[model samples]
Target: MKHYVLVHGGCHGAWCWYKVKPILEHSGHRVTVLDLTASGVNVSRVEDIQTLEDYAKPLLEVLESFGSDDKVILVAHSLGGIPAALAADMFPSKISVAVFVTSFMPDTTNPPSYVFEKLIGSITEEERMDLELGSYGTSEHPLMTAFLGPNYLKNMYLLSPIEDYELAKMLMRVAPAITSNLTGTKSLTEQGYGSISRVYIVCGEDKGISVDFQRWMIENSPVKEVMEINDADHMPMFSKPHELCDRLLKIADKYA
Candidate 1:
């Protein structure tokens, strides 16, 4: 069976993949869900995390632990794309394919934060009001993190049912410093990160990321293939778990 490492987005944990994990495993593929530092059940405190490298250590460590010739299909959702890309760069040979699901697919020229800033500029005034960068630190320890505004969870994240939105609010945490880290410079070469195959999954009804921004990222940093799930929101694993699983399995069958 092929191995798949599923990475969750900002403020989310491995728990987000509960729906997709079993479906993939039932189909005879190995699946591992990850919670980055300070996310999900991880004990790492947000105050303790300063750099992107520290935040991504969990994912990097998992990839490094794998023996040579042990390859995986790296699936990243939303902000998880940043670290997944870094992992692919660190172990190009170990990653059979990197699937970016409604996530930022950055390159040396266009990093994650660059794409984020551009998206910020393209949104409407009302959308701008809904995007808040909450401060979670004291004067001595400054922290800038983004969280969706009121009513945004249902509109941007859930798009499935009201109950799912309630669950998301209970589960969601403050995002790590990774988003800010993307604004800074990162070392990613064409041979290192670009060598591995990549796929992009677009969520047609995504309001958090938006289809236009997703398309912009795809155009900026091209991928080998692209897949779209209509009426799917930012959290497709919750909104369209079966369809997401099917598409993922198809990707694994074709590339892994």
Candidate 2:
């Protein structure tokens, strides 16, 4: 069976993948989902994450535990793409391909934080809604955090089921704004992160990350292929799980 590692985005935990996970497992694939530091059910406080490395600990540990010959299809959503990129860079051989689903895709030409900064710049004040952004570290080493407000969550889950929306409201937590830790970090290496195959899955109706921005990202850092779920919002896992799974299965067949 092919292995699929699903990583959730900011302010979300592994629980967010509940719908998608079952479908993959039913198809006879091994799906591994994890909670990054201070996210989901992980007990660590957000303050404990001071750097990108600190935030990516859980995923890195999981990758490290695999056998040298073991490789996985790394599927990431939203902000989860940053950590997924880091993992691919560090363990290129361990990743068959990195799939970014309505998520930020970084390039080897800029620091890991470039895409996030572009996102922030593109979002208008009204578009940001009540989402709260804060800092936990001092001026010298500023660490940022984001908490998704109810209104902001609504827009993100507009096309999703009400039950899933309620579930997110109950489980969402304060997430580390990875841009802070990645500020001065060097860009991904061509010989490492660039060597891995990449794919982009666009959510055509995503309000949080607009389709324009998604296309911009794809153009900014080109990938091997691009797929779209025309009616999906930002939370396709909850809105279009079957369609999402179909695309994922196709990727597994081609790359895994």
Best by lDDT: 2
Question: In candidate 2, where is summed lDDT lowest over 10 consecutive residues?
Answer: 176-185
Question: Could you report the Cα RMSD, in angstroms, for every candidate shown?
Answer: 2.3, 0.9
Residue 188 in candidate 2, Cα distance off native in Å: 0.9
For residues 1-256, what per-residue lDDT tens digits would candidate 1 score against the true structure? Answer: 9999999887788998988999999999899888898889998876666666667889999999999989999999988888788778778999999999999777766554566556656778776665566665566555567665557666766567666677778887777534445335655668978898999999999988989889989888889999999989998998999999989999999998
* Candidate 2 residue lDDT tens string, 7-77: 99999999999999999999999999999999999999999887777888999999999999999999999
Please identify model 1 stretches exceeding 4 Å from their true place: 135-143, 177-183
The segments of candidate 2 whose C-alpha lies over 4 angstroms from its true place after superposition are none
Error of 2 at 40 (Å): 0.4
Q: Give the clash count for each candidate.
A: 0, 0
Error of 1 at 189 (Å): 1.4
Candidate lDDT scores, in order, read 0.81, 0.92
Candidates in order, TM-scores: namely 0.91, 0.98
Given candidate 2, what's the lDDT at residue 155? 96
